[model samples]
Target: MIILASASPRRQELLSLICDDFSVEPADIDETIENEIELEKMPEYLAVKKAKHIQGNKHFDDIVIGCDTGVFLDGIMLGKPSSESNAAEMLRNLSGRKHKVITGCALLYKDRCISFSQTTEVEFFELTDMEIEDYIATGEPMDKAGAYGIQGKGTALVKGIVGDFYNVVGLPVAMLNKKLKEIISNAEKKL
Candidate 1:
């Protein structure tokens, strides 16, 4: 059986494109990023933690996937907003600038694990305060990293993207599909 360790609907939806048969098992773990973790490695660190947390004894024979995404602007990570005002501030900071969206993914089975991170460069149009306020009013940015959902109403905020569009949505479907294929192939070979 294949299991996904995430509560984000976007990740679940993206995973479905790779495999139709799977279960959602959101991992329960502390998500706080420690000061010692490099900003670029934060996603992968959290992702491994989540996947490991879900891959306990019961799921020893099953494959578990965990993913963590973050938006980085000028070296600082902009996580999910704490409030509507914080969302606005995030949007303002991203205005007319290029930022990176990185999603770290880990796949675990038994004692084996595979992990990788995908980065997408997204540029936003110069946003006015009114536009930021309006987008925040839609309430789509509250739960999304960087206070924007590139796949939803927030699409209007993006000017262009240089990498996998799906990566910005929370998962890199193509890369994930490739990784899943490798794991399944090796497992079958062992059998």
Candidate 2:
């Protein structure tokens, strides 16, 4: 069985494009970014951690997938907003600036584990305070990293993007499908 260690509806929707049969078993683990982890690698580290937490010897024969995403601007990582004000601050900081959206993914099957991250450069149009306030009121940015959802109403805030569009939505479907196919092919060869 394929098990996805996430409860995100967006992730679930994306993963369905790669695999038809799978189960959602959101991993329960501390997501705090450790100081030891480099800013660029934090997402991958968290993804691996979450996947390992869910594997735990119980899903030895199953393919377990975990993912984590973060938005980086000016060398700092912007995670999910804690409140509306925080979201507004993030939007203001991102106004007319370019940032990166990185999604780290992990796939585990028995002793084999594969992990990777995809980065997308996104540029936001110069935003006014009123625009930021209006977007925040939509409530879409509250639960999203970088205080914006590229796939939702927040699209109006972006000027351009250079990379996998799906990555910004929280998953890199093409890369993930490729990695999953490779793992499944190798597993079949061994059998």
Highest lDDT scorer: 2
List the pairs of residues colliding in candidate 1.
none
Q: What is the lDDT of residue 137 in candidate 2?
A: 92
Pairs in clash, predicted candidate 2: none
Q: Lowest summed-lDDT stretch of 10 residues in model 1?
A: 52-61
What is candidate 2's lDDT per residue for 83-146, written digit by digit as tens? 9999999999999999999999999998899999999999999999999999999999999999
* Candidate 1 segments exceeding 4 Å error: none
TM-score of 2: 0.98
* The 10-residue segment with the lowest total lDDT in model 2: 53-62
